[model samples]
Target: MKFALVDDIKTEAVKGAKGICPSCGSEMIARCGNFKINHWAHKGRRKCDPWWENETIWHRSWKNNYPIEWQEISLLDEKTGEKHIADIQANDGLVIEFQHSYINPEERFSREKFYKKMVWVVDGTRLKKDYPRFMKGKSDFITTNKPGIFKVDFPDECFPYAWLESSVPVVFDFGKLFESISGISNPMYCLFPKHENYYALIAEINRKTFIKTTLNGEWLSRTEEFLKQSKKTKLNRTFIQPIENTIRRKPSKYVLERGKWKKRRRF
Candidate 1:
């Protein structure tokens, strides 16, 4: 993790410094290597939390965006007395998790349930094909009357399926911030899951705007306004065509089999 308790005080890892794990209170050693970012590690190479993953440069960069106190906070469950360290616990009780690796749906759901109000900042650049796959799925979005909100038919195939049914909001970090076809700047795509529909809210703001709006719980309101404006204005169709590729593909094998069975039973 980025910070450890040194003499009961949260401290960043420095060469030759010793610390303690914030969660388990175990002895931790600072690892300052040339290849990797400086970070604290358990002395015996053991992990206190099963959910903890090795910190990467990407993870560190995200943590650096917030204050040091907000990073790696230990949260307690009032009823169960269980504790888990959050990636970032904002002042408003919002947990921002920087996810680099893929975890099962169960774990993802468990984290969300424990945090209650949380958001995921997933690394879209983790895999080479992630962007292409996401773009393919985005192409099939069903426009909604709610402006920035949208309804996706097969989100399981288009999104990181683990977050498809997430109870809270999720923002996908597509590596770089650029101007969209609509002439709006965006740093990430926000996916808000409601019942059976996955609504994709394109963020028309830069990275700082995203951070600030999210912390203040104003992103949803901004999204609505952006969508309203989008409806009134005309976007560049040529630029939209790339991301809106319209080659309708066949359904999955399971879907095909289910359709066939339904047809046979009807006859």
Candidate 2:
């Protein structure tokens, strides 16, 4: 983990430093090496939390974008007595989990359920095939009426299958900020939770804008409002589809006017 409890305060790992794990209150010893980023380790390499994973340079770099106080937050479920350390919990109770390694579908779903109001910032550069597949699928991205928002037929073709069924927003970071690809600016793509007509919704969000809105707590509210409105729109479409289909297949061009059926013949 990035931060541990030292002197009753959250502190980063330093060489030969001893601290306490913020979540479990276990003894933590700092190990600073050239190979790995400086981090606190439990005795005998045992982990207090089962869900804890090794941090990567990409993960640490993303964490640095947010404030130190917001990083490595420990959350507990009072009813179930479940406790886990979140990567970042914003001021407005939004959890941001920066994932750089591969995770199975079950664990991913579990994390989403635990962090109800959360977003996943996945590192897309981890796997070579992932970026290529996404680029290939980008050709099929249908433009929506809304700016920067797109409609995708099969999101599984573009993103990892594990994330296609996520319950919250999943933001895929293809490259670091200022990293250009094919001479074009690389922006993070966010996949929304809901899908309509098997068409997934993805938004091309600027990295800086994502960070800014997320920091100021606008991202959560905006996402909630969008999902709410999307649900209404989808219901309206579903309700109107049958009527439109029936009218198209009616075969007879007749209209009820003045209590009598008026017929018109096709030419």
Candidate 3:
């Protein structure tokens, strides 16, 4: 949604600029409103892509972090002949989607399948109750052997359940606007889904760093660095350690109630 084709070249939205949609080749007009961020819209107010969502400041902020070439890339599936524009398709085929709105589980699964290697950057502060629910769910978190990596025993009760069973990794932006922070130091939490539990990897570097590492296949090395750094204060029982110790000693259990998990009462 950020870029349209002007004079057969990808162009950013500017006031009074007329262009064409790169995806559907439809006529587009630049919308530079006082209240909303400037963007391109189909001339007839029609949607070319059914999967497209209304762009927000949150989405634009994330897209601006990457290079212009990498933003709004059109990907085609040779096998299925399906085409879609990725929010960001890194140099190494890693698709990063910045999601601010709610989506059903089916669509989430379909997107994950289409993009074999991808990561989701969700806006966790979208709803008023999101942060409070996540805070409550944190009580059931357990740290993993990998520093900054934690396991949530019951993920269904968490804030973003749409991606709970996502095959790819997911990073949550707790509405911590990344305006002033450098790309490499943007703090985020990565979630990796397993059979019944979800592993949460705390961001050591900024969002940019994580993306670079993942693109270069250096994520394992990054995890190692965090593990070694975590040991220096192992004795002091810092933030990650205590949870790791607690889970190591006695893992908590939950019961399914009305499609959600309820922490079992301990005697």
Q: Which candidate ranks first by TM-score, i.e. highest?
A: 2
Give the alpha carbon lDDT tens digit for every residue of 1-267 in model 3: 789999999898999999999988999999998898999999987987767898999899878877888888888899898998899887767788888999898898899899877778888789888777776665556544544455554554455656655666677777454331213345666665333222333432366676667567576454446545644433122443333233332443655454344567888
Question: lDDT (CA) for every model shown?
Answer: 0.69, 0.79, 0.69
Q: Which regions of candidate 1 fall more than 4 Å away from where they truly are?
A: 144-147, 177-181, 196-206, 217-245, 252-267
- Compared to the true structure, candidate 1 yields what TM-score? 0.78
Off by over 4 Å in 3: 177-186, 196-205, 214-267
Report lDDT (Cα) of residue 223, candidate 2: 90
lDDT of 2 at 229: 84
What's the lDDT for residue 30 in model 1? 92
Better of 2 and 3 by lDDT: 2
Tens digit of per-residue lDDT, candidate 1, span 1-267? 888888789999999999989888888999999999898999987987777888898898888888888889888998998788899888777788889998898899899899987888888767777888877666776544433344454554556656665666778887663344334456566775443312233332356777887667675465456555655753333333233657777653222131121112322
Instruction: Please state the error at residue 43 of candidate 3 in Å.
Output: 1.3
Report the error of model 3 at residue 44, Å: 0.6
lDDT of 2 by residue, 1-267 (tens): 888889989988999898999888889899899999988888677787777889989889889999999998899999999998899999999999998888897898899999899999998878889888887666666665555667765566678877877889999998853433223355889998787765778888888889999999899999999889887765332222111122122233443234222354566
Better of 2 and 3 by TM-score: 2
Deviation in Å, model 3, residue 80 alpha carbon: 2.5
